[model samples]
Target chain A: MKIKLVFVSLVSFVAIAFLIYQWWPSPERAIKNRLGGLAKTLSVPANDGDLGRVTRVAELRHYFAQDVRVRAGASGPEITSRDALLGLIGAWTPPPGGWTIEFVDVQVTLGQQATSARVYLTAKVSGHDARTSEPTLDAREANFSMAKQDGDWVVTSVEAAETLQRPGSQD
Target chain B: MKRLLFGSNARLSLLRAAVLVVTAVVVFGYVLLPVRLQGISMLPTYRDGMLNFANRAALWWREPARGDVVAIRMAGPRVLYVKRIVGLPRERVEIAMGVVIVDSVPLIEPTVVYKAPWNLPAFTLGDDEYLVIGDNRVMAMENHDFGRATRDRIVGKMLF
Candidate 1:
């Protein structure tokens, strides 16, 4: 009887363990998917007042409880929600120049507060410029922070890394 | 024979440990975790990081009443937001500056607050929309889309 009881309990335990392990990470993934989808809506080319929405979007990250920080490769003024839109305005006046950029990899960690995501990607630039005669290539790793307001997710800030100079190209 | 008995016991113990860990994670990850994660934002009554219960089942028994605080899901596909219920669906909501008058009666705002800049009108709310604004109007609270939190998105009310 004693041996039979032990065997029964062990089998039951294994069954329970298998069930929980399979569904455990769902809520976290749900939150991430929600935040990411909302972010995609705001990822259009920065335009007039669009930056304000971006600021509010950035503020969403704070709900996840992380601070926002940003690092950029191009030598330009820091982009704010308003600035992002204004930058486009400035870019469009004479259409200064256009560049192609994509985040290589972005990992967003969703939690109560202090939410942060790391983004990796490359940018291809090609246009008439006083800076960089040819198409300059730059890669970066950026960390984004998320937060909450009322009861929604916001991107409070971002921190991006600076890329080093090419092997032989330092004038 | 002795080795067989010991080996089986050890395997059983390992299985038990695995079960305990998994059970803890489910209870912690789903039910307990969301409760603790839900919190009061920017209000003195509910301090920052204070965990609050959500009464989603309440809606099943009765219609959501006026002045009850609710956790609403915003339009951003996957966003979960909380706010005080100021207007019922289809009720005409009017706002001037930061104050709200629903059916011409002043609705009591939540202890935690915000006001959107854009005058949140009844039209802005698509059929299932609920107009909820924060009490603190400092952060462009008086003019923004945060007010038009939809009803279908509401998870439940905040349990104080």
Candidate 2:
């Protein structure tokens, strides 16, 4: 009877341990959470003035590596230097009133060595143009290559992958 | 009455449940894996949102034959593609006038829906490579991401 009780107890303990292990959060999940937070932070506008632009650039720079290359649109040339990329972003003047951007459907895939990852996300930007107050809706997918530095994931490059929907191809 | 709470019947029941759980894990994880279709690439045959099973045990016993629908792993095991195998290892494949040519012989694909023109140059597969393509050939060739599926990349054959 005592031997049977010990065997049952051992099995129960093992099953519970296995369940816990399955439910535990992994490194991949942690990296995904970081990327999501960064994407959300990027959507916020900082085109109020020079200070606002500076703050925005700083916040954006925090999520990127020292040597980052950014390619805005599908046919846009690659911005090799990080400073040049920031300057290009700073040059953009916000539409008269303001704008809002949201990132959705974020998917992150860790590389074979876990030192790098590719993040696929959809960005929706909506606002009115300064010249024309017509509200505009633009959606695009951004594929980001991230590298791990000092134990923190940082964006190394960004490429506009594809449009969420083809133009006039609703069918 | 206290011993009755943990009697032979209760122990047997617990053992049965454990056996059932183990069997399910082994069968689903290693033998019969479930996959869900995501795009119109395999339209008319395996539509989007359809669910099916891939038999891994079949591949273990025999080589994957031509015209067999297979699941290929992409971006790791989480993302997979369901495509029909048209070219075997070390075979030359080409797409001409919406027809698939293997070793200079045009294949008779009854289920193929050709709405777009395709004129791709012939390419030879590697020793352990197999060419795969979707049944919906109507889509533009540039949009379709079909090519050689290595031996290790093919997960298994579709059950149905």
Candidate 3:
């Protein structure tokens, strides 16, 4: 009876430990949380004041690395530095209905060293057309390369993943 | 009522419930991926907010044939595009006045209800490449998401 009790305790302890490990904050989870925060920050409210807009855009710098590279589209121009990206973001204007940005289907692959990760996700943006005032929803796949910097995951590079290539275009 | 709900033994009933849940997760998550249509890209045939299933095992026996409405996976499977296959592998595909031409032959598309006068230069698809486009041609060619997708990107065929 004593032996059976010990065996049951051992199994229960192991099962609890395994569950805890699975629930613990992992690198992938950290990166996903960071990306989620980034999405929330990127979303704009229609009634946002000028101060809120500037503050939100300024907060974007914390999510990116200093030497971050951003490519909005396959053919779009690349932004080399975080400052440049923030500058463009500050100058951006949202429609009357504002913009909602969400990152879904986020898949994170950790690097061999565990200090770096590559995230593949679909960026869904919903807003109103500036000219027509019609609601528009656009989704595109994007890749984000991030590294652990000062105990935070900071995006180092971002590129839009174009699943289909344009006709007659040579890349 | 209690016996009918929990069977003769509680442990056996719990085991059966677990098995049913596992089987459902495997079947729906992998075999038949449930997808909700989002945009007007595939108008007329599949409207917005329509629920459909993509059979991941549909192309197991044969390659994807032309005119098959397939799910085009983006980076991962979380989000995908539903498009109709037009140009097969190694075929030259071009859009002249919104009519798709394959190898200098005007392809007949029955699902396309509206056609925009869109012109695209002819381009030859590489090996294992298939051209995919939405059914709605009313939208401008530049605004629509249609182009050459690789074989690996074609996840599965749509099951209406």
In terms of TM-score, the best-performing candidate is 3
- Residue-wise C-alpha lDDT for candidate 2, range A9-126, written one tens digit per residue: 9989999999987767865666666776775655545346767767778887778787898887766788887788778777877665667776565678889998998887766676
For each candidate, give its TM-score against the true structure: 0.40, 0.63, 0.87
Ranking by TM-score: 3, 2, 1
lDDT of 2 at B60: 94
Q: CA shift at A8, candidate 2, in angstroms? A: 6.2
RMSD per model, one decimal: 18.4, 9.3, 3.7
- The weakest ten consecutive residues by lDDT in model 1 chain B span B73-82
Q: What is the lDDT of residue A19 in candidate 2?
A: 91
Runs in model 1 with CA error above 4 Å? A3-171, B1-42, B73-79, B108-127, B142-145
Better of 1 and 3 by lDDT: 3
Docking class of 1: incorrect
Q: Runs in model 3 with CA error above 4 Å?
A: A1-21, A127-136, B1-4, B7-9
Q: Please give the distance, in angstroms, between residue B121's alpha carbon in candidate 2 and its true position after superposition.
A: 1.1
Candidate 1 lDDT over residue span A75-110, tens digit each: 435545534533343344221343434433345454
Residue A145 of model 3 has an lDDT of 97
